[model samples]
Target: MKFNEWTIKDHYPEMALQDIQPISLRAYSLLNRNISALGPNEGAINLLGALEMLEALDYHFINFTQIEKGESPINQKHEAVAYLNRLGQLYFFTKSRFTKKYIPDSESHMPKVIEFISIRHKNTAHRSLDSPQKEPDEYRDRQAFTFLGATTRKFLGNEQYVFPNYNKDTNETEWFYFTPAIDHPIIMEQSYNLIEKIIKELLNNL
Candidate 1:
C-alpha cells in the first residue's frame, strides 16, 4: 500500500489477455517486494503484514453471465460463487503449465478458498475494522489460512477460533491480537515465489 508502487508505471504487468481478472492483477500491483522498509517488525500487522496484506486484497467474484448492478443478497452471492468457482478451476485447482500437468489433489478445497475470498473481501477489505458486526465465517477462512501457510516452507500446525465471555459486556474490541506462526518468515519467502510464478504466467503469451 505504498505510493511508489502505483507511481512507477513499469511496475505494472501488462494484461495482454482479456481473460485475466482485474482484481488479481491489482492484488499483485499492491505487493511490497522489499521488507527492508519495515524496520523492526514487532506487531501483528507488521509481523504477518505480508500474509494479511495479500489476504486483504479485494477479490471480487465477478460473473459476467449473471451481471447484477444492484440486486438482492442471494443473487449476488450465487453469481459470485459460480464465477469464482470457474476461475479457481482454471487457475488454481488444475496445475498445468503449457504442457506438464500437475493435478492439485484428490481433496482440493478450492470452493472454500473462493468462499473465503468472498467473506474476507466483504468483512475485511471492503469495510473498516471499527464496524462492530464482523461476518462470522472463521471456519470458512481456515482452509485459506491453512493452504497459504502450508504452501510455504517450514510451518507448524495450529487451529484458530473466536469466542467471548460476557455479562453482555467487554467494551468494544478497540484492539485485537493474534500470534503469528513461528515459520512466518518462510511464509513471506514462499509468497515471493508464488508472486513471481503468477506474474509470469498471467502475462502476454506473445
Candidate 2:
C-alpha cells in the first residue's frame, strides 16, 4: 500500500508535505565539518555514527514503502527486518550520544523506540533459545528462531507482515509464530523525529 493511503499518514502529515532530500542534505551539511579540527575528544565520532544510522533508518523506511503488495515474502521480510534493525540502532545512538538533554527517555514515544531496540536484540542481534524475563513483559515468552517466509502473513495485503507465533507448548518446534506488536509507520515517524532533534542539537553544540 502507498504511504499516503496508510492510516499512519494522518499522524505524520509532514511525511507527505515535506521532501526527504532537503532534510537529508541538512543533516549531511551539519556533520560535514572537519573531524581533525574537532579533535578526538569531541563528540564528532558519536555524531558521525548517529548520522550514519539515521541515514540507514531513512533508507530502510523508503525501501519498505516501495515494496509492492504480493511481493516475494523474502523481499517483504528483508525490508521488515532491515527497517527494525536500523530503528533500534538509531535509537541507541540517540540515547548514548545525544543524552536526555536533547531527547529524554520520558518522552511518550520513547517506549516505542525502546521496544524496537529490545525486539532487535532478541530476534536479530542476539537470538537465543529461551526468552529472558525482563521489564518489558511482551517479549518474555518469545523465543529466538529463524523467521521463515512461510510464517509471515501480509497486513491488509500491504508490504507489512503480521508475524504469528507457534504453539511451542505442544512440543512441536518446527514453526515459529508471532502476533504483530509493532506499528511500522508510527515507529518510523517517531524515530525520525528523535533523530532529527538529536542532529539539530549536535549542530547547535558544534
Candidate 2 residue-wise lDDT, 141-178, digit = tens: 34432455434555454444433233235533222222
Q: Look at candidate 2 and give me any clashing residue pairs.
A: 163-178, 164-177, 164-178, 165-177, 165-178, 166-177
- List runs of model 2 lying over 4 Å from the truth: 1-18, 21-26, 29-41, 67-71, 104-109, 130-146, 162-185, 199-206
Query: Each prediction's Cα lDDT score?
Result: 0.31, 0.50
- What's each prediction's TM-score? 0.24, 0.56
What local lDDT score does residue 89 receive in model 2, on the 0 to 100 scale?
68
Q: Model 1: runs farther than 4 Å from truth?
A: 1-23, 27-59, 62-71, 91-94, 99-195, 198-206
lDDT of candidate 2 at residue 59, scale 0 to 100: 72
Candidate 1: tens digits of C-alpha lDDT, residues 1-206: 32232321223556432233343443344333322232232221322333333333223322322445555444533333343333333333223342122222412322334323333333323232234343334432432342233222222442221112111154322211111232222323333344434333323221
Clashes of each: 0, 6
